[model samples]
Target: MKPAKDWHAAPLPADEAKRLRQLRSLALLDTPQEEVFDRVTRVAAELLQAPIALVSLVDEHRQWFKSRVGLDVCETARDVSFCAHAVHSESLLLVEDAHADARFAGNPLVTGAPHIRFYAGVPLRSSGGLVLGTLCAIDTRPRKLTPAKQAALCDLAATVEREIVQREAARETLEVQEVERRKLRVSESRFHTIFQRTPTGKAIVGLDGRFVEVNPKLCEITGYSADELMHMTFQEITVGADLPADLELVAELLDGRRTTYSFEKRYRRRDGGTVWIDLSVALIHDDEGKPMHFVSTMQDISGRKHSEEVLRGYRQELERRVLERTRELTSSRTALQTITDNLPVLIAHVDADLRYRFNNQVYRDVFGVEPSSLHGTTVRETIGAAAFEHCLPYFARVLAGERVAHEGIVYEGAPNRMWNATYVPEFQRGEVAGFYIMSQDITETKQRENQMRSEVMLDALTGLPNRRALAEQLALSIDAARDAEVPFALFFMDLDGFKNVNDQHGHDAGDALLRQVAARLKKTTRADDLVCRLAGDEFVLLARGITSTSACSRIAQDICRAIARPFEVGQSEARLGTSVGIAMCAGGTQTSAEAILAEADRAMYEAKRKGRNGFRFASLLAEVAPAINNLVDRGSATRH
Candidate 1:
């Protein structure tokens, strides 16, 4: 054995501190003996017929044996270890005779018992480029190791490295899984609470439509006990007119053609009265994606339905009095017709069959038809197919004793006009007999509203999406990416030397340059990619479905090159470059839009720091040093 004094006097490698950290990260030092490591050492010793073999991890003060054969001691002083020198080399270190070597001539290990003579060790390097220790073979007799033996030792060391890396990876995977499991447990707990307390009539129904489970609200809505509802199928309670449609939707769900559906339907309560409900139903699936059951939420809308009926009745009574007065003043028909013909709004009455029973002169003027010709014509024939389809659903609701009002476009004249149309049901003997239609032009109002909305969402100078629009789109993109599990990259770009343009060439010229830059960015990116003017001299690009960092870098490069081209502003040409920072989220990573934007912003500044006109990916900065270095070198070359 070597003297303890000499062991403390041995010089440490330059990377000794870093290597010790890497060794500790493996967590193999002073660990219990593992059969896997022991097997490797045993095989290595048998191959070389060495008296001793060890898998040694060099720590700050000691060389610890993770696995050893023909060795009673667990550790030795680091300075006295042959493996210490091996850890400093990238390849195998061999000594045919330690006694003859100058470094070991006065060493106690060579001069004392268990005399060291021959030694061969291969450095075990970590993925981070730090050599943690060595896989070594030792012998008391002075003998040289052949080329084959040296190669074998290196191979064994590589195996040891692989084992350590694999173990670390396995541990990390287990930790991630544990975190996920805990989150799932919390989510399930919250879901259970909401499912039990939600006020909506929630129920779980079997594929056959029989109630498998029902909440308290469902029982109250249906006026049935839980036991009563469980014994009945959903089709049994549904109104006859709505049953067929509901059954078709349920069939679609079972066949996997649709996962969820919503519709307005009527159901018969236990008391034999009809209740209107807005029903939303979804199918739950098993692990294999087989349909398991239907989850349904029903909200009662009977009060709203009743209010509509009451409003329809009052309107119908008013229409009846007006018709009676018109009949009574028939003797003054010419005066009445003259007054109505001069009015701007269109007025008409349609019977339950949708046939026009009456129409004023203004209605004829709007449709470009004679007043007499439209009296007996159906609305569909008078308005054309597209408009008829648009009005049909509201008409049906009107005929169902509901007052309906909606806005629509009419394209009959030289210019298209928008109209606010109201349909009031004419009730007779507690049923809808006909309906009166009133339409008022609102084209200018609609146009102004649309213009205001556009102004709010668009950048006034560049005509690109403004910050508000970018935020909205970014939110949508994040949701879509999460749902589809697709990767996307967000780039935060700032224009370099833009302030100089404003200083040298006036603000108008600066604005012009910005508009040109926006156009260039739009032209250089894909149609689906969103490029927005975030603020003055700043823009953002959201690139979807990126395959890799290389692709994202290419996009940034394209933008840089496009913006670098000279811009013509009135009498002068302006030049500016773009610096970009990219933040990426792969599929299934839960990251917010704001988080990604912040990350990209930080990276953008990093690019600017490394001399502008380049892009840097946030993830690669810490994990891939070589790639980052290469990017910097390439960027410098491009600048030159």
Candidate 2:
């Protein structure tokens, strides 16, 4: 068992004393409860479902209740006052269960007297951002509030605030009448009011530079209390180097030489840190025109100074990088010249007007023009008019930011040899400035176009078409399917248990297993179907003339059964299943090879998730676009 908390007044806000002054100035203390206030509390008590409601004013030693309903007391000591704690909060202080909160548990209010179990209050504030008191609700039982109820309570609190502001305005009107008799007194009061509430740091400095008066904003900027500043002179906290210039300005102001002065300087904080401030000062004269005080205003500019320094560093670093890039480009131009000259190719830089900028050394041997002399010469002069006509179409493409590659007898010059030319666009700030040409004499290679290059397209282990050949075949098949008004299906397959076969039997057996799987796939598909080995144990099949999904499923089922048969490898037996994903492509559909490959790969993983040795459609795991879904049959495009 723990003893009850004897004292829980809570820590006060920095403006607590000023708030107390404002609360007392309202002149509502110890007054009889009025209908204006009781009417609001009556609404809050009923709307919040609380037993008691009060418009509580917190004084120096106690919370005095101006308006109350469902409660007997008019006042409670500050030590046991919930409104006293609520006054420190900027907004509502809601305690669902006072008995469960460590700060309020076992307090006198919960253990005796009102026996408060639930408490909620909204801190009433002044125009100067000071919390004066709270409009509170009290309950004898532990309870909770919905967001709607809490909002309703805030609306009720706003009514109480409007009533308080009206009373304060009336009191100010009376005080203004009394101060109007003395003009200087009214001016001084207004000055004090602005000095306390202004966001900028301000102070009244004595002529002798000794301690005078500092506002809360100044104290906040210098990280010092008003008491600490009052005991010290301005010179005590100013940076030593800045003191001389500041004193010169202050002297001129007093001697009627300068009316005001403004400058940027450093001020030393109490914590031994320096802060940059934009300081502006003006002379204040009292009655009879005698210079009285210097009113100094300061704004913290440390953040601006930091950002300027960072921007300067970034600018210098960018300049250095630009210089480095220039040197690298110079070296690369020299290296590219040497490399292009060694190859049997005519390389040149041509401007947008079709005139040459420069040419490689090979141009001298091929075109009978010196590399430097080729500059300023038109392509019609070097390669003849017929070649320039052929080059016009390529120029349009490269200038439009497309790289063009073609090989034919376009340049019908003296030798009349076929040339394979690639035009690469040069860009300056995202615009096509010009282009560089790399033309190789591939006249011999074109003669062997009809030859079958088995080394490039055939798989060495499986004797099937590899990925390079598969790409060419797939493109042809897609065009054929679109022209013939038929469809094609792509099957992406992956071995499931093949890793075990490789680990237990070794790489030799794994190679043999893949070769056997490829042969099985070839035997399982139709004569028109193309079985291609993509990479490792993964294979792809392109079956054109596919009109229905059932036909594709039949082919996948046959391949899966063939691969599941037992294999013989180095006197050891191993088995692995296959997962197939089919990507259905209907006729006249504009589908990219990459999109189809990705779709099939994702569906293959879905098939793996459905216990292996199974096949799934890409549409089962991915959403097909409306255009593509409309092209294919519903059975092939049904989303899972």
Candidate 3:
């Protein structure tokens, strides 16, 4: 055996600092063995026909096994780990005869216990492109991995990566949800404090407009005790002129036509004198869709109203001053128009009748209409049917004196655009006269969010739906099957002898084979059937609306046959078969996606146990949880 030359003193990767951070983020260092990870290592060892397999995570000073199929020790020093070197490699690091390799010939791992002879490793890369560790197979006897076996090893490694990424995503989602929940709690606390302690009159009224409960400030404002206020309706205290209009709004609320209404009105105090108040009321509903109560807040505005009346007595002098003020207002209007026209957002005003009163230049630029010509035109006529319909409900709420904010897609011009719009009620003499509209183009932002979502749900290598997407599709299929009262089948397939192709020809050839296989699987399935690459050589097909178990068996057979055909990659032709297991959901039955997939997985292993290149079907009624008693022969399944 050649003496090892500074193998323990190998230089760190260039991105070592960033890589360590990425590894730590997974929170998996020194973690106990998990079945999900252990299964991958077990499969790797069985398929590579190696005695030992490990899901190794390389830490700063040691290599820890998240899963160990044959090794006794839970971890080893980084200096002697074959995985340390393998993590730095982009492709599989294979040492057919470790004693012949200078790097490991005299290493402690090779010279001491276990006496490692053969090794093949594929780096476990995080979604962010950092190499965290490796999924490796080792043997006590010297042996080379066929190209197909190498590919199978790589596939197993990819599965480990998928598990890591999915866990990370789920953790992040939980963190975000926790933050939102905390914020909600804080907001509720603040709202409660304000509602109880604010100086404004606050009360809860029944559907009859009579106070059901009143705060201290409300009693002070009405010159009555809380007990007295509870007996008197708002209509009884309101002056005659404002009473009828307020009652009409209450009627709208009762009919569920409006959520809120605000207005200024006079209330006759206990002393028989009138006081003006600005009042806002919102309807609350019970869980069973019944009107529960209304929340009302009122601010005394008697001083301001009195001052306005005093100024009205000087009408002649006020009229003379108004002439000068009108000129100043014109200049201010011009300045405001200049600002609005230069802004990137669309700004406009529409009356209660939905007629456009005014709009900025940006409106014309986006909608391709003359801003001046929009005056007195109905919104439906100006923006066409699609955009108008999108805004109609919000428009109704705003015209009813409620503020509305929403996001929607506007399909106009060459391509559709996303927008965020806000509508605020405009008041004339304390009544809703119109609404001011502001909309910002959010197309770029929306597209970026969609792209991120797509990337998260797709497999970067094979361009197939990843496990996350498969789970979602399976859930949808389950729902559809239950709704339509029909049966559906899930097929779990593992490629036979894919590792040999990776071992002989190279990982590039292995990748090409996977992509080709994915394409073939997609082509073989019906358009409505979902085909997903779960991880590595494993793929899942969801056959929705299947009629019977016989149909599922035939589909599974067809897939196995299709995959048995030789794959042409460049100058080489590699052949691989499939072991398929199918699970069917009966009509009108309730079953979760996880339950169905688990059944299919069990059946697939049954096929592998029986022999490669065949199909097996298992129903929900079958006993699917039994452990495998023997390992399948890896050499029997091969790529040319």
RMSD vs true structure, all candidates: 14.7, 28.6, 18.3
Model 1, residue 330: C-alpha shift (Å): 8.2
Residue pairs with clashing backbones, model 2: none
Selected candidate, larger TM-score, 1 vs 2:
1
Poorly placed runs, candidate 3 (over 4 Å): 1-333, 411-415, 484-486, 621-640
lDDT for every model? 0.79, 0.77, 0.79
How many clashing residue pairs, candidate 3? 16
Worst 10 residues of 1 by lDDT: 1-10
Instruction: Please give each candidate's TM-score.
Output: 0.46, 0.31, 0.47
The local distance difference test score of model 3 is 0.79
Task: Name the better of 2 and 3 by TM-score.
Answer: 3
* Per-residue lDDT of candidate 2, residues 336-355 (tens digit): 56666776667777888778
- Superposed by TM-score, candidate 1 places the C-alpha of residue 34 at a distance from the truth, in angstroms, of 41
